[model samples]
Target: MATQNEVIFRLARSSRSVPRARALAHAVLSSWGVSQGTLEAAELVLSELVTNALRVRVPSDRQVGVRIARSLEDGLLRLEVSDAGSGRPEVRVPEDDETGGRGLLLVEALAHRWGVEERTGGIGKTVWAELKAPDIVAEPVGREVAAVLVRPGQWVRVWGEWRAVRTVDTGPYAAGGLAVVLGLDDGSALRVNAAEPLTVWNGGSSSAREGGEDEPG
Candidate 1:
């Protein structure tokens, strides 16, 4: 169910509606205090979904619908674009020369999950995508650890032991703006909020970048 934070808009079937939908998404997410990464991904996903909705052959009197909802409890932000068209969207492999056919591909790559469903009490379907909220950890004040930024390959103390940051997931609905998967030395793993005020250590560095599952520690 959508919370009180959800925003819905009726968009005209014109190219200009894409930017309008994106602007609405940005404003709503910003008011909710989402992280930069979350805002960027949500806007892109919104643009793609709206663009596709506009491309469908709907009646001139029918307007596309855009809905943005945030689940702070679940740490997720969902974007939904509804159109009167009757087709389901699918991800396709675009040829090297294709300028289009990659919208859903980008949506698939960026969204944590995405799909289409018939609109409630409506004649068409709503294409939706969910983005996991990013964890935004504020720097501790007046301490050396305050300067320690958490990213992939950074060593931070977890449960009194040092663990490597395996991956960072920042999408809407994530608590404190981000979640970090920590690599344990014993070949196990753990997940924690990056915003948690924990001590970070400068244990020797590795070349791992953010966004992927790490090998057993």
Candidate 2:
């Protein structure tokens, strides 16, 4: 059994990358047997984080980094968006007349757990969220992400739906106890340690602005 688990993408800093990233996540997660409810939530989380990262002002040469990994502790799905930009993300109350600013609010609500941190080995920061991924039992006809038996051109019953395999390749091992596959493209994934809980911006009872920010993903 190949244990390498993770999918990493270095996307160009553009508004178009937002939809593309979400699509990639949906395809990969679906192929991995992620439940529909959890899959929807995960895509929203990814969208918010990626959208926010693109809003940050960074050097033209820099790109936004996205990572998707499952937690080994309990198969929780982790989503991370990192950028070489400025300014820490804060949850603030929006004006009553304001049209937008509710991103973090929704993130705090949808994600089972979410947070931000100083980017490791990078300039700015990374915003991440972890969604609960219920363990899927192996079915005779259906398949779980075994990383070996599952290959391109196979139709496997994922979670509860049937999906076609596209590509599968080993990736990098993320430090911090994550068995990530480096540079592994779509159709590849790995598990990681359940990361630290919400830290950077508190989502406890009271948030900074309380009311919230962003249109969200």
Candidate 3:
């Protein structure tokens, strides 16, 4: 009976949305304070799920949906991808000569538990994966309001896309409780609190800042 807070993003039906979904997942999950390993695995799982959803032969108007939520009852992080298509997606052993068909296999291995469910609208299915996400705090009062003052040269999620921070204008440290401004690569400035909410984009892959998340390229 716990209240659920989820970040839901609607992605256009295109192959490019795959990486966007992954980056969005990284933003949201990192904000939730998931471990580095869990964050990486979640990214991969989301990428595969989105890829498979796009592969489904759905109508042109059907867009893909991503939902990220935490099950407070069991303390598990849930990731879901919905597509308005038919039939179930199963993990089959690929032939030795095959070059593909291993997406779900990776999901099955990484997720603590995952399955497919009939969507509520009665048109398609939702593929979900749950992982043991420790250290994620309790649900916040506002579901969609996550913001943080970013540092220069770091990647941050703003307006549903990963943007690199060009510069940060902290105003003056003398003024307590003042909002911080972040100048992004898109030539947009965002003001936010220096609190725990907006996710700093780190893929946990390497030590290089530029090599972290692909910046605009």
Candidate 2, residue 121: Cα displacement in angstroms equals: 2.0
**Tens digits of per-residue lDDT for model 3, 65-140:** 7888886657688999999998999999999999999999999999999999999966899999998887677644
Highest TM-score: which candidate? 3
lDDT for residue 159 in candidate 3, whole number 0-100: 78
Q: Candidate 2 vs candidate 3: which has greater TM-score?
A: 3
Candidate 2 wrong stretches, greater than 4 Å: 136-217
Better of 1 and 3 by lDDT: 3
lDDT of 1 by residue, 11-102 (tens): 65666667656655665576577889888999999999989998999787677877777776688888988999998999999899988999
lDDT of 3: 0.72
**Candidate 3 lDDT trough over 10 residues, lowest sum:** 205-214
lDDT of each: 0.65, 0.59, 0.72
What lDDT does model 1 reach? 0.65
Ranking by TM-score: 3, 2, 1
The segments of candidate 3 whose C-alpha lies over 4 angstroms from its true place after superposition are 1-4, 139-217
- Looking at model 3, the pairs that clash are none
